[model samples]
Structures are given as C-alpha cells and as structure tokens.
Target: MKKILTILMIVIMSTALFACTTQSNNEIKQDLVVGLEAAYAPFNWTVTSISDYSYPISNQPGSHVDGYDVQMSKELARIMDRNLTIKAIEWDGLIPALNSGEIDVIIAGMSPTSERKLQINFSDEYYRSEIVMVVKRNSVYENATRLIDFSGSKVVAQRGTLYDDLIDQIDNVVHQTPLDAYSNLVAAVTTNVSDAFVAELPVAESVVKSNPSLAIVKLEQGYGFESEESDITVSVGMRKSDTDLLNEINSALSQISVEVRNQMMTEAVLRNNESELTLFGLITKYLSLFVQGVGVTLLLAITGTFGGFIFSLVLVFGKTQKIDKKRDNIFKKIIKRISNGLSTAYIVLFRGTPMIVQAMIFYYGVKLITDISWWTPLSAGLIIVILNTSAYIAEILRGSMNAIDKGQMEAARSLGFSRIKSLLYIVYPQAIKNALPAIGNEFIVNLKDTAVLSVIGVLDLFNATRQVVGATYDTVTPFIITALIYLFLTGVTSIAVNYLENHKAGKELKDA
Candidate 1:
C-alpha cells in the first residue's frame, strides 16, 4: 500500500510540474484564437470534413468548424499574418472566454448592443441582418405581417440576446423562457412549446429552408421591430484592453466589401442546407464522434469515482477522529477540532449544492483567479466530480464506520496497534467493504450526471450529441444514440460491481 501511494504521489507531482512548464509556451503562441457557438447555422456550425473553408476546433480532434464566421476569421487571420484557431464555446461562455484570454476574439455573430459594450469592445460590423419571427407553417402566427399581429401569443427567443428582449414588443405577449441555442428554439417552435421565436433574417431563411414545416414572418415597412442600429449588426468582440487588436480587426473588415460579405453569407447558407441526409446517415457520418464522446465520459466517471473514494477516506478520518479530552495535549485537541470542522463543512457544502452550479463556479472561478492554459474543461470537470462524489461517499463511510463493532478497536489496541494503524488497516477497510455498494451506486450516478459538464464545454457524451444536433439539425436521433450509450455503460458497470460484491461476500464466508 505504501509503495502504491508513493507511485501515485510521484505521478501527481510530475503532472503538476509539467503543467506549470508548458503554460508559458501555450500563452506565447501567436495564433489568433476566435470563439463561436458552432451550433448557429449560416453564421457558424460544426462539420466532420475539413476543407479550405473549414477550420479545426482547438483540442477537439477530428471536429472541424465551418461557416461565414469561420471564413471571415480566416481572412482576418491572413490579414494579420497569424494562424487562426477556432474554439466552439457555448453562447453564454463566449464573452467570459474572451475576457479570460482563452480566446482572443468572439466571431459568433454577436451583436454589439449598448449593454454588452460596457463589458467588452466590438469591431466594426461584419454582418448586418434584419430581425424576423419564425413560426410554424400551420400556426396562427404564420400569416402575421407585423410585430403586433402576434399579440397575446406565446413567443420565445434565444436567451441573453437582443431577440429575447424584442419578444416584449408585442402587447400582452406570452413570452416564454429563452433557450440557450437556436436548435433549442427550433425544437420549441416545432413541438408547439412556443408559437414563434425571434431570429435574424438570414438564420430564419436558413431554418425555414431546411425545416419545410417552418415559415418566416417578414414584416413589411413600418411593421418590424423598432430597435437601435447596433442591435441589428454583428461584430467581433474583444477585451476592452485589446484596443490595438480591435483596430487591426476593423481594418481587415474595412477591406472586405459589402458585396463580398453578402456572397460569403449566401455560400454559407447553401453549404449549410446541402446536408439533406436522413437521420441514419447523420449518425453513420458522425459515428466516430459518439465513440470519442463515450471514451471521455468513461474517463471522467472512472477517475472521479476512484479519486473521490480515496479522498473520502481522508475526510471520513478527519471528521471522525476522537481527541482524548483528559490525556491528549492541547495542541492535538485544537488540531482535531479544526480538522473536524473543516471536514464537516466540506461535506455539507458540496452535498447541498447542485453539481452543475458547482461545475460552472469551479471552471470559470479558477479561470478568473489564475489564467492557466493547462486547466482545460476536462480537468475542471474531474475536480468538480471528485469533490462532489467525496461528499456523498464521506457520509456513506461515516454510516459504515458506525455499523462496525466497538470491540474491534479495543481488540486492535490490545494487540499493541496504534489508533492510526487500527483505523487504517482494520476498521477503515471493514467500513469500506460495508460501503462498497453505495460507492458503486455513486459511480453509476457520476456516469450519468457528467452530462451537466457540457455546460462548461467538457466534450463529454452529451456535448458530443449536441454537436451532432448542431450539424444535422436533428435532435431526436442524436439523443437516442446518447441515451443508449449511457444505458450500455451503466449496465456494464452494474454487472462489474455486482461481481465484486459477490466475490467479497464469498471471501468473508470462507474466512469465517
């Protein structure tokens, strides 16, 4: 056991040393890092194939991003004489990523509204598009000609955008909760969860073209949304401190004529709508992505479960240590009290909070405090799962410890074993055996709950499926594949854990 612990310690120390050494080199790389939500069509989306127009996303192997934004980014990179690097960040995370220096600019068709200007600076408009409402072809709002025509109807839009704010323009509008992605809005409208959703003219055209059941309500003159000019124009976002880089990007944009930009956008729409394959074809085309996603999911679950088990043991010992009030030194008593208080707080805090909330806080919070390039989404995810699982495992271990007979401790003491040795070798081992089933359940739970890590862009199973949905615009098939993969993983794990339980039981019977 001591030899194994020594090896583990050495590996951890080496990894930390390597990370610190490589961070500086990564920071100094002169690539132009551009962040975007690849789920948006025409503007940006993921593709399996690489071409002159498609750029590979950083750290996500075999996944290429393509769209007008990607082409524009490539042009800007060429103009600035730098290699372009694209990151498929979630919409809500793009600004945070840019601010944290994870990405140098945001080219995600983001509008530079007054509210957003306070946080980050924007370049001159790269794309100007009119706002339109997308509705079901058979819905009552399909024939509507103006904003007020859909009054008292259930409307929705993508959250944290100008479109979401525009839903209130209709008097007595039943505005629904804004979703996170355009695909989600598509689903909402298609499923009748919402009457209509606000979208830019190009996006509406692209969506309507692909989804025959959908239609766009393009209001005539004097019937559209009344908004500021900035709300209708998309721009590249950068840090307020990056005035020099922003000016260079604007200069590059100035060189591209409006006619050329429109041509690029038209080409994007055509390319985006070209994939008319059936659902099965999409699954077959992207099968490798699902396979990779499963591998990452399993890695997170296995590492988090075993790592958490080890840490839970430490927490259990800390929280359960008993200081002799009469004979122990004052120093020992104080140390024991502090350790117990800390252990209790850790378990309570982690257990009480949701894992998704914890993941966001840890991922962004760590980036906020220390801008370490080595701390990727996977690392942050592992830390979150381990911390969360340890809390539950600690409680399980505590109950298991209480179930053990008190005489076992006395027997070890009688045999001249120290309290630490008794707990480590005899008592704790028995407690772990008793808690094995609960620990196994925690592992299975981790396998499923790792889906939440997608919010922080971990590229786990759920995120992979979302990538497929973004590419194909078919939500049902990809999710079905994801569910089956999860079911297979959990089922196999259940069998393995049951085998271990039975083996332990047989070993105990033989000993008795």
Candidate 2:
C-alpha cells in the first residue's frame, strides 16, 4: 500500500510539473498570446486541420483554431514581428485570464464595453456587427421585424456579454438567466427553454444555418437595440500596463481597411460552413478525443477521492481524540485543542464554498504570488478536489465512527488492547465497512464536478466535448456523448460498491 501510494504521488507530481512548465507572460514578449473562446463561429472556432490561416491552440495537441480573430491576430503578429500563440479560453474567463497575465490579449469578438474597459484596455474595433435575435423557425418571433414584436417572449443570451445586457430592451420580454456559451444559448432556443436568444449577425447566421430548425430575426434599423459604439464594435483587449503594445496593435489594425476586414469575415464564414459535419459524423470522428477525456476524468476522480479519503482519516482521528483532564499535560491539551479547531475549521471552509471559486483562487492567486511552473491546472484541480472532498468525507467518517457500537471499543480494550489499538484494529475496520458506500458516492460526484475545472483549462470530459463542439459546430451530439460516458462511470462505481457491501455481509454471516 505504501509503495503504491508513493508511486501515485510521484505520478501526480510529475504531471503537475510538466503541465505548469509553459511560457510565462514575461518570457513571451516576442510572442503574442491571444485568448479567445474558440467555440464561437466565424469570429473564432476550433478546427483539427492545419492550414495557412490556422494556428495550433496552446496546450491542446493536434487541435488548431481558425477564424476572423485568428487571421487578424496573425496579421498583427506579423506586423509586430512576434509569433502568435492562441489560447482557447472560456468566454467568462477571458478578461480574468488577461488580467492574470495568462494571455497577452483577447481577440474573441469582445467589445470595449465600459464595464470591461475599467479592468483592461482595448484597441480600435476590428469587426463591427449588428445584434439579431435567433428564434424557432416557425415561431411567431421568426417573422417579427422589430424588437417590440416579441414583447412578451422569453429571451436569453450568454452571460457577462453585451448581448445579455441587451435582452431587457424589449418592453415586456421575459429575460431568462444568462448562460455561459453560445452553444448553450442555441440549446435554450431549440428546446423552447427560451423564445429567443440575442446574438451577433454572423453568429446567428452560423447557428441558424447549422440548425435548420432555427431562424434569425433581423430588426429594422430604428427598431433594434439602442446602443453605443462600444457595444457593436469588437476589439482586441490587452492589459492596461501594456500601452505601447496596445498602440502598436491599434496601428496595425488601422492599416487594414474595413473592406479587408469584411473580406476576412467572409472567408472565415465560408470556411466554417464548409467544415460543418453531421452530429453522428462528428461523434465518430472525435471518438478518440472522447476516450482521452474519459482517461483524464477518471484519473482526476480516483486520485482526488483516494487522496481525500487518506487526509480525511487523519482529520477524523484528530477531531475524535479524547483528552484526559487528569493525565494529559498542558502541552498535550493545547495541541489537542488546536488540532480539533483546525479540523473543524477546514471542514467548514471547504464544504461551505463552491469548488469552481476555489479553482480560480488557487490557479490565479498562485500565479500572482509565485512564478512556479509546478502549479499546473491539473495540480490545482486535484488540490481543489482533495480539499473539497476531504471535508465531506470527514463528516461522513465521523458519522460512521459514531454509528459503530461503543461496546465494541470497550470489548477490545478489555482484550489487552490500548485505546488507540482498539480504535484502529477493532473500530476502524467496521467504520470503513459502513462508510464504503458513501466514499464511492463521493467518487461519483467528483467525476461530474471536475467538469468545472475546464474554466482553468483542465481538459476533462466536458472540455473535450466543448472542443468537439467548437470544431464541428454540433452542440447536441457531443454533449450526448459526454453524458453517456458519465452515466457509464457512475453506474460502474455503483455496482462495485454494491458488490463490496454484499460480499462483506456474506463474510460476516459466515463468521457468525
């Protein structure tokens, strides 16, 4: 057991070391690190083909990203005499990534809204697009020419975006909670979760073309969203401190006329449309990625759950320690009190907070304090899972220990065993038998929750599916594949737990 644990630890540490050893912000002065949501079509999207206009996404092997933003970034890199490196970041995480020095700029069709301007600087607009509504093909809003025509309809948009804010413009519209991705928005509209969703013209066109059941409603000029220049114009985002770099980027963008920008968008749309594949074709083509993602997801789940169980054992033991008032010394008493307090506090802190927030704090916070290459996304994710899972397992263990008959400990003590020995040899084994089911359930939960780690770029099952969606523009089938994989994992775990419980019961009957 000790040897096995040591090997696991070594494997985890080695993976962390390799994952974190990427080029830091300061080391990439000659390289332009551009961040964008590669899932968005026309503006940016992931592709497997390596073409003259495509660049490989950082850290994603065998995957390349090609879109209008990518082409523009390439031209900007050429003009600035720097190599362009693209990173496919989630939309909500793009600004934070730039601010945290993870990427040099955001070219993901982001606008220079006032809210975003306060955190980072922006270059001149590269692409201008009008807002449009995407609705069901035969829905009432499909033929509506103005925003007021859909006054009572339920509308939604991607969260933290200018489009989300624009949803309230309709006089009596039902504004649904914003989702995180355009693919999600597409799902919402197609499933009738919302009557319509706000989108840019090109984005709406891309989605509508792929999904024949969907259609676009182009509002008349005066009836559209009332907006400012910042809302409609997409620009490159940079850190506020990089004024010189920002100025150079703006100069490069200025040299490219509006006609050239339009030509690039046209080319990107043509390419994106040409590469579109059927849902079944996409699943079959990307089966290898899905399999790889399963391996990663299982690795994280097993290591995290096992590590948490080990740590929680120590914590439960510490919290359940008995202090003898007459026999224990002052130092012993002090240590006991401190350990109990710390155990309780740790349990509360981790269990009370969300895992996603913890992931962000660890990933970006460590980067701010230290430039250590060993703090990779996988390592951070594992740490979060261990810490978070430890708290729940501690509570579960405590309950299981309490449920064990007190007479068992007393009986063992009378048989020439010390209290510690009684607890470890006699009490712990039964407690573990009772707790095994809960531990297995925790493993299942970890399998699903690890999907949240994709925000920090851990390529688990969900992230792999997102990459497929980005490449194929088919949202439904990739997600269906991911769901089926999760179901299989949890189902297997459940069956294993049940088998162990039944086997243990049968052995106890034989002993009796």
Candidate 3:
C-alpha cells in the first residue's frame, strides 16, 4: 500500500511539473521559429561547425544548419527584427509542426503545390528551379532526353515531395517506393536499389557535384514533365491565420533582386561542395557525433528498460487485484474491477500498436494541448518507451509469477505472512529469478528499437546517421558506422545477460 501511494505521488508530481512547464508565446511570438528538413543539399543541410553561412539548429546542440533556405530565413528574420531559431524536422513532419504551433514558419525548399495551399498559406516565391532526373554515370538513362525514354527503368524520389509525385510522369516506369531523404535517394541510385530519382535542378547539381559517379538527365524543354509554375517555385510555409506575417515576409522577399538570389544560390552550391572527404575521413571528422548518438541510444534503452520494470510492478498489482465478495465492501470491489479493466486495456492498446505510430501520435498530440517548448522529443520519447514497455513487461511478470506453485503462497499465509509480504518476500524473488533472462532480452530489444524514436526527432543512432549523411552526402559510410555501434551495444548486452543466467543456474545447483 505504501509503495503504491509513493508511485501515485510521483506520478502526480510529474503531472504538476509538466503543467508548470507549458509556455504560451505562440500567439505573441518573439523569435522567428523556422522549420526545415536540413537534409536537402544547397537548399538546407546540417553541418558540424558554425560559419558565417550557418544558423544554429535549436534541437541539435553543437551542430548548425546552412544552405540557401537558411540564408533566406536569416534575411526574413532580420527584416522582421526577430531572433532567428531554426529547427531540423523530417520533411513529412514540417506541415504538422507548423499547424500544431510548434514552429512559426517552414523554409525547407517546399514547393507550394495546389494540394498544400489548402492546409497552410505560402509566402511569395523565394526560389525557382526545373525538374531533372539523376542517374548512375554510365547507366542507359543517363543519355535519355525525354520522360518516355526512361520507360521500364526503376525510379524513386524523396517521400512526400513534388519530386516523388513527378515519378508518375515517366511512362511505364517501375516507380519504386520513395525514400525519406535526398541522401537516401542518392544512395538508392548509386547502389542500384533504383535506376534513377527525380530532384530539383539545384539539388541534382549538388548531388552530381558531390558524387562523380552520378549524372543528370535534363530533358528537352518541350519533352520534359509538365509542371505548374507554382510546382517549380519554393515558398515559405506558415499558418493560415498569420496573414500579417505573410505580407511582411513577401515584403522582405521583394527587397532581394533576382541577381542576388542567383548569387546566393551559387555561393550555397559552392559551400555545399566544400567538403571533400573519403569514408575514413568522414568517420574521423564526425567521431564525436557518433559517440553522442551512442550515448543517447544507451540512455534511452537503459532507462526505459529499468523504468518499465518498475512500472510493470504497479500494472501487475492492478491487474491481479483480488475481488473478494465476502471481505471486500462494494466500494473496494468496484475499485478492483476498474483497476483490472484499465490495466488490461493499457496492455492491449500499447502492445497492439507499433512504436513508430505511437511516437508520432504522442509527440504531435501533446503539442496540440500545451506549448511545445516544454514537451521536447527526448522527454516525450522516454515517456513513450516507458509506457509501451510497461505493457509487455507486465505480462512477462504476471506469467512468471503464476508459474510458481500455489503451495508457496499458501505456505506463506500458513506462517502468518500477509499477502503483500508473502508476494514481495517469497514469490516475487523466485519469479524474478525465473524472469531475469526475459527482462534482459527487453533491454536488448530497447537498444535496437529506440532507433524508431528518430522519426520524432529523438537524436538516436539512426537520426545521428541521417545528420551525418546530410553533412557529408555519403549515406553508406554513416549507416555502416551506426550499424557497427548497434552491434557492439547489443553484443555486450547479450554477454551480460548470458553471464547472469549462468550465474543464477549455478547458484541454484549449489543450493540443491
């Protein structure tokens, strides 16, 4: 009873802290909070070091963002006389983030297509470029000049972008599944996962410049994919309610001449090509980031595993509460019934859904209710992991406890031990001894599963690899390093689990 009361107190205090941390500044915003993918080269990409061209990324410490998008955002913020704050977000999450009030504007080289105009208002055009297909240097598609020329070839693009939609324009093309980033598309083409990928002219140029083995196929003007003028022009994305801010942004954009815009893009392209590193060079250069990623991954896995174990105890107790008709009053029986129902519901709900979906719903859903400033990705990620993990661990504990003989509990009661004391002192210890291996497996599972947290911008190993890919434009090397790190972590964990199992078995034999 005391333990349950303490857990309730901690939960209440946490709720209070969460309430206290909410801030309501979106209505009267001070900073120009800009959101972008930061993985689209020349448009926006992440970098390790700060420069005159780079803007600090609010979510990623010790890293910065640079490219044409960042430069345009800088000018916009300066014109508005507001401090600039850039956030690196996944492409698919940008519109949702803007709508949920998590970000003020999006300058992520987003084309203001007719489809997007319904959800959010777009500022005047900031940049324009034609569509082009990128292919392996010596591939047959490299010489193609028309959409029909590439028929029967596999093609892809970044997921949820105009580029991906353009794939349908190619006649009889395989139309492979779109990837999540330009880096992934580049990798797909280079590694033969796909024959080609559609990209904007500047982006194609950036990829070709970074990779000598890739080439661009620019179709004849009349034979190219038909596109609307707005489809080719990138604009600032903001909430529909921000009419005044939209006009002000357009005013700031008008101040820059076409010549200056071209010049800025040229400079950005040059800066994007500044890095010339081999795989080994990139690994050495970005070693610290990999280390930081490993640290965050381990932190989430360890804490999530231990924290889930603790919470699962409470869940087990709730689900297993006795409904004594004779000794229990009507109020007590009702409480027990409710507890069992809730615990069962919680386990079923969490176990039934994927963690990726849960993370997206929880992370974005929280923003709808409170100021996003307090509900950060890491905080939300930890809570999600704990809650999801508790459901599974509860069943594990319950099954392990039940496997023990009823004779043990009856004997304890015969010795005048209370129900709680008997379970805690006699039954739980042996159940834990039986369940240790499964609990250790949960830890290992967390070490790998936490990679999904990256979708919600948790900065786990996978997210770190994506950041490195954004900076270096070499997708293969970063992922290889990340895989190795994951292997090392899981390997160590497995060895530890094996040792604990062996030790437990040996001790039992000795006691016998």
Candidate 4:
C-alpha cells in the first residue's frame, strides 16, 4: 500500500514538473513567437507533414501550419532577423495570448477593427480582402449577388468575430448561433445547418476549392454588409505596449510592396492542400493524427482521474475531520471549521460552474500572474481536470465514508490504533473501495468532458478532429472516426473498471 501511494505521488509530481518544464525557450532564444489558429486555411491550417512553406506548430506535435498568415509571419520574422516560432491558438485566445506575453504577436489574419484597436495595436495591413458568403453550390442563394437576396435565410459566422456581428445587418435573417471555427462554419453550411456563413474572400475560396458542394457568393460592392475599412484589412496584432515592435513590423510590411503581398497570398492559396479522397481514404490518410489525439485524450483522462483520486483523499480528510461539540475544545472546533469550510467551498465552486467556463478562467487567469511559458493547453488542461475532478471525487469519498459503520473506527481505536491510523488504514481503504465505481464513472465522464479543453487549444480527440475537418472541409468522415475512437476508449475503460471491481470483491470474500 505504501509503495502504491508512493508511486502515485511520484507520478503526479513528475507530470506536474514535466508540464512546468515544457515552456518555450523564449528567455534563452531570440525566436519571434507568433500565435494563430492553424485551423483557419489560406490564413492558416494544420498539416500532417512539413513542407518548405510550412512551419511546425510549437505546441501540436506532428503538425505543421501553412497559409498566408504563415507566409507573412515568416517574412516579418526574416526581416526582423529572428527565428519564427508558431503557437496554434484558438481564435478568441489570440488577443489574450498577445496581451499576456504568451506570444510576441498575433499573425492570425485578424482585422484591425475599432474594438480590437482598443485592446491591442496593429501593424499596417498584411493582407486585405472583401467579405463573402459560402453556401451550398446549387442552393437557392448560389447565384445571388446581394445581401438582401438572402434575407430570411439562415446565416452563421465564426464566433467573436466581425462576421458574426454582421449577421444582424441582414433583413429578417435567421442568425444561427456563431460557431467556434471557420471549419465549423463550413460544416454547418455543407450540412444545411445554415443557409450561408460569412467569411473573408480567401477563406471562402479555400473552402469552395476543397468542397465541391459549396460555393461562394460575392455580393456587389453596394449590396454587401457595410464595414469599416479596418474590418476589411487583415493586420498583425500586438500588445499596445509593443509600440516599438509594431513600428518594426510596419516597416517590414512597407518593404513588401503590394505586388509582393499579393504574390505571397496567391502562392499560399495555390499551396493549400485539399483532400479529394473518399471517407475511408481520408481516415487512412489522417490516421496518425487521430491516434495522436487519442493518446493525448487518454493521457489527460487517466492522469487526471488518478491524480484527482489522490488529491480528493486530501480533501476528504479535511472535510471528514470530526468536530464533536461535546468533546472538542474551542481551538479544535475553529480549526476543524476552517478546514471543512475550505473543502466545502472548493467542491461548491467547481461543481457550481461549467468546465468550459472554468477552463477559460483558470487558463487565462493564471497567465496574468505568472510566466505561463510552461502552460500549454495540454498542461493547463491536466491541472484543470485534476482540480475539477477532485471536487466531485471528494464528495464521492465523503459519501462513502459516511456509509462506513461508525463502529469500525471505534473498533480500530479499541485495538490501540491512533485516530489518524484508524482513518488511514481502516476507514479510508473501505471508503475508497466503496467509491471505486463512482470514481470509474468520473473517469468515463472526463473522457468525454475533456473535449471542452479544445477551446484552449488542447489537441485532444475533438480538437484533432476539428483540425482534420479544417484541412479537408469534409466534416462527416473525421467526426465519424472521432466518435468511434471515443466509443472504443470508454468501452475498454468500462470493462477494466468492472474487472477491478470483481477482483476486489473476490479478494474480500476470500479473506472473509
């Protein structure tokens, strides 16, 4: 038992230490770190293999990023005389990452809109293009050239972007909930979930090229949704304090004339790879990505569950500290009360909120206080799951503790065992045994729930599937594979958990 506990402790500590050490060599190296959503094609998208035009994504292993954004970033880094380091972040996280010093700049094809200018400074326009709508190739609105023509049609856009806000401009339009990624927007339109989705010209072209069933609707100049000049121009984003860096970037942008910028974008479009393979072939081509994603998913789920179980033991002990009114002194009562209050508060706080909300708050909130160089999505995700799971598991253990006969503790005490030993050796073991099934269930729940970690850019199974979809614009096959992989993981886990239960039961029976 001591060996087992020691092993678990070592594993937990080692994992935490490793995560802390995975920080980029920002302090030691002169790399020009940039953040972007590699899921966005033409602008940026994930690729399985490296090419002369592509850079390996810093965080997502076995993946490379290539697009107009990458091209611009590479040129800027070259002109600045710094090596390039790309971090593939979620769209919403780009600004936060820039402001938090997670990356030096955001070269994610973000527009320098008025609202954004308030949060960060921008370099001169790197790429400028008009907005267009993507829809089913032969749909009713295929040949439509005006925004008014699509009135009453379901419109969607990427969340937290100018595109989503523009939906309000369509007269009598059914504005569907904005999706998280451009890939999702493509999927939504392809599946008829939305009649059309707003996108930049390059994005529209990229998707249309990949998806034969989709087409682009370029509204005439006076017929499209009105926008500010800044809204139409994609610029490099930096923290407001990065005035010097911004000036440097603008100088680099100036050196590259309009012809060069246009040529770069043209090359990126031509370089963007689109899969023409059947569903089975697509799966075969991207099977490595799926396996890698599953590995990350299982690593998080298993480590989180085991780590949570161990941490929950501490919480359970805190909450279970007895405060007998008749026998306990004032000091003892106060100490017990404080411990119980903290434990109760932790459980309530985590359980009271959604995991996704908790993930955003915890992940970004930490960035403000410390050098989160070590805090990749995977590391942050592990910590979040462990803390969140501890709360629930603590409650589970507490209930199981309550179910333990009070006489058992008294019996141990009668045999000359101290109160600590009585609980540790006698009470805790039984409580854990009784709570094993619930713990197993939590593991299963976490396997699915960890999908939310993708919002922070953890390339778990779901995020990996999104990357594949983003690349191919064929959502069905990737998701079908993802579903099957998850099903297999959970199914195998269930069997293992049941086997442990039966084995433990048999051991107890034999001992009796």
TM-score of each: 0.91, 0.89, 0.91, 0.91
Which stretches of candidate 2 lie above 4 Å from their native place? Answer: 1-29, 274-279, 408-423, 470-473
lDDT by candidate, in order shown? 0.88, 0.86, 0.87, 0.87
lDDT of 2 by residue, 59-163 (tens): 555567889999999988988878788887777778877888888999999989999999999999999998889999998888999889999999999889889
For candidate 2, give the lDDT. Answer: 0.86
Candidate 3 residue pairs in clash (backbone atoms < 3 Å): none
Position 79, candidate 3: lDDT: 79
**lDDT (Cα) of model 4:** 0.87
The CA lDDT at 269 in model 3 is 92
- Which residue window of length 10 is worst by lDDT in model 3? 20-29
Which has the better TM-score: candidate 2, or candidate 4? 4
- Cα lDDT tens digits, model 3, 1-512, are 99999999999999987766654434344788999877788899877777899988887666678999999999888877777999888777899889888899999999998889999999999998889999999888889999899899999988878778888888888989888888888889999999999989998888888888899999999998999898899999999999998998999999988888988899999888845577788878777778777888998999899999999988988898888789899999999999999999999999999998998899988897788456888888899999988998999999999999999998999999987898899988888888898999899899989888877677777787887887667788788888888899899999999999999899989999
Q: Distance (Å) between predicted and true CA of 60, model 1?
A: 1.6
Q: State in Å the error of residue 47, model 4.
A: 0.9
Q: Write the per-residue lDDT of candidate 1 for residues 340-426, one digit (tens) a residue.
A: 999999999999999988987888788878988788888889989999999999999999999999999989989999989999988
- Candidate 1 vs candidate 3: the lDDT winner is 1
What is the Cα-based TM-score of model 4? 0.91
